[model samples]
Target: MSIRTNVINLTEFRNARTGPPKRSEPESGLMLGKGLTDQTMIDLIKKFSNPVSERDYRNRALLNLMYLTALRAKEIVSLKFSDLFLAPSGETLISYTKKGGKLAFAVIAEETLFFIREYHSTFEGDHAYFFLSLPRGNQKERSNLSTRGLQLIVNSWNVKTCSNKLIHPHSLRHTAASKLMDLAGSIAVQKLLNHSSPNTSSLFYTKPYFNASKFISWE
Candidate 1:
């Protein structure tokens, strides 16, 4: 039997605020916190997602995919080309074994698809994984990009801009959820974030700073 609690921890926020976490900070200011604010997330997409150079293409695609799908950090790194296909509804979707070996689905955004196609068009070599590490001196190795590597790339986006919040990759997931909650409430957010229950989704939205708006529609 699964036990569930739908309580919000008001005091937990105060406790968390008492001290800086005893750990490494964001490599490039990826922007994690109570949650990244909505406008800041939009600003991030606009600033970094250029898809110009090989590295640009990869980072741009990665950022857009992270925001669009709201997949977990490990799940994002675990994606393969074979996982994506056209759904009967004519929407592009990815099907894969999730945690606990459960089958799952996530819809891809059109902007994400465009960025991915640009990435593929510019990428140097093929790999089993969809995204690869552009290791110096030997780019074609097509090594599986580790979750830490993905974290660095994502955090790097805000390095130049700088932020008060210490950003993490999961910040993208929360940013997506905050936006989704404003647009579709907790149930829709539960679907996007793959929470076991809508209450979990609501809990995330209840975070003090997660006042997001609209949905994933970037121009």
Candidate 2:
């Protein structure tokens, strides 16, 4: 016999405006590494939306999908087409390649899919990996992008945090985590970012549970 469990929609997308700081009552995001303001993140997305070269398409995809989904640089770089799917709900689902290959998933907005498509169109070969290294001089290409290469693209954008630290891949991740935490609370952040303890249930216990990804909605 099959049992049916209720799927809860926990998503709470805040408008892209700064809220008053809760100095007296700290939020879970406060404990996280410093991240960009929501407005700044939106601005960054707009900044990279235009592409002249294939590399530009890759960068635009990185900015939109990575920021929207809160993926770690390593996971984003390690992504292959096999790890992605479009759910019946029409949301983009990604199975992250995290440390030890631990399972995780997050939903991305449909518009971000356009950026992904534009980026993938530039692939020199029909490689399995979604992000790849650019071809140099005469060498044949289509290698998966490394974490360091992801860093270079992020750096080329010259994004920085409040402390002026270059927004390395991790900083961008922090920004994504903060975005989730700010509007959805720590539980939603945990659900989206897979911040479970060894004692807790994996947020994505079953692939079917991907239906719960609505909680992390960017809208």
Candidate 3:
């Protein structure tokens, strides 16, 4: 015999839990960061290029994937080799856990896939995680890259590029979303970002499409 507990009350309990918001300011509107442009991204990638070490390849691939896939830093760090799949259409399908513990998939571009393949080729043996931490000191344990480590990677790139605004890993996500929203429609960006709320994606990522100046013509 087994006893069953209803979890609906647990939802009510969790919903009552509240604390300070993560950010001091709002995530969208005027508070949002001035995301990187395509040219800036290109320049940053060039700066990261170094043929001597395999780490450079990994860095390039990591940054490119963030920009192309619009994946969160946590999602990227949590990625395992098993989560990646090659579709019959030649697209890379990346499975990741979203904020709500929901499983989501993002399609990787061919260019991004090329870098990922290049990075993967350098690794020997079957690794549990897609990205591993660099060997440090006597620490022989190989583990996945931490979220802080990934942030530091992005910060190092930002400093090297001498970017006016501080660019972090999430900035890459914003860049991808903003750029895609501009080129494609809100629906496209919403789907790529795996946003549960289409309004949030559209209102935040997609800039005002129509020119306000056009509404008022000089007579």
Candidate 4:
């Protein structure tokens, strides 16, 4: 069965027995899970050429921005040109239009800036959307990449890298959260991630327990 089907079945069974559904808390603690490490990210950059061709350059721009901003796939896919701007200090800011049109800013990295410039140079369509799709034949309508497409891209990269790590597109967000927590603390992470509550941020800081090795460190 499909993963979603399995999940729905499991949820139905659990709810039938429990009377009311129970909400699970977000995982807490440092997790040694699969994600794009610094080296892995470098490898991806090398494997995929910049602009990779005109039609895909904007897609690549979105991918890089999502990784840097730690934005959810849906948020990234739905973003438009008007949502982006340059601040007085020369930092590129992305204004998210979700969650009651909340705004958040992330400083643009030099590498990402280069990709964005390259994408803008090659783009030809009049679409206001930052990312556009090319239609095939006369039947299919062009559209931006969906959330599922984003998931598949990450999964494909994970498989290509041949790491046994279970990396998801969301793992980029996790990595950003971890880095923010380490550099600025949980409160800063909460703000940068645009979490509605501190409790949401706390879950990312929780370390997963694995075997007894973590507790039995030799001093």
RMSD, one per candidate, in order? 12.4, 17.5, 13.4, 10.6
Per-residue error (Å), model 4, residue 79: 1.1
> Among all windows of ten consecutive residues in candidate 1, which has the lowest summed lDDT?
25-34
Tens-place lDDT digits, model 3, residues 70-188: 88889988987677798888777878899789888888677777876777677555676667777678765667889998898888775322235778887888788888877997788
- Residue 190: error of model 4 in Å? 1.2
Model 1 error, position 162 (Å): 12
lDDT of 2 by residue, 52-157 (tens): 7887888888887787777888888777777778888877787776666777777867777778777877655577877888889887765889989988888887
Instruction: Predict model 1's lDDT versus the native.
Output: 0.73
Candidates in order have lDDT scores of 0.73, 0.69, 0.75, 0.66
Deviating ranges (above 4 Å) for candidate 1: 1-33, 159-163, 207-219
What order do you get sorting by lDDT, best first? 3, 1, 2, 4
Record all residue pairs in model 4 with backbone atoms less than 3 Å apart, i.e. clashing. Answer: 28-206, 28-207, 29-205, 29-206, 29-207, 30-206, 30-207
The stretch of ten residues in a row with the least summed lDDT in candidate 2 is 198-207
Better of 1 and 4 by lDDT: 1
Error of 1 at 118 (Å): 0.8
TM-score-based ranking = 1, 3, 2, 4
Residues forming the 10-long window of minimal summed lDDT in candidate 3:
24-33
TM-score of 3: 0.73
| Over 4 Å off, model 4 | 1-27, 30-34, 49-51, 55-59, 88-90, 99-113, 137-141, 159-166, 197-199, 206-219
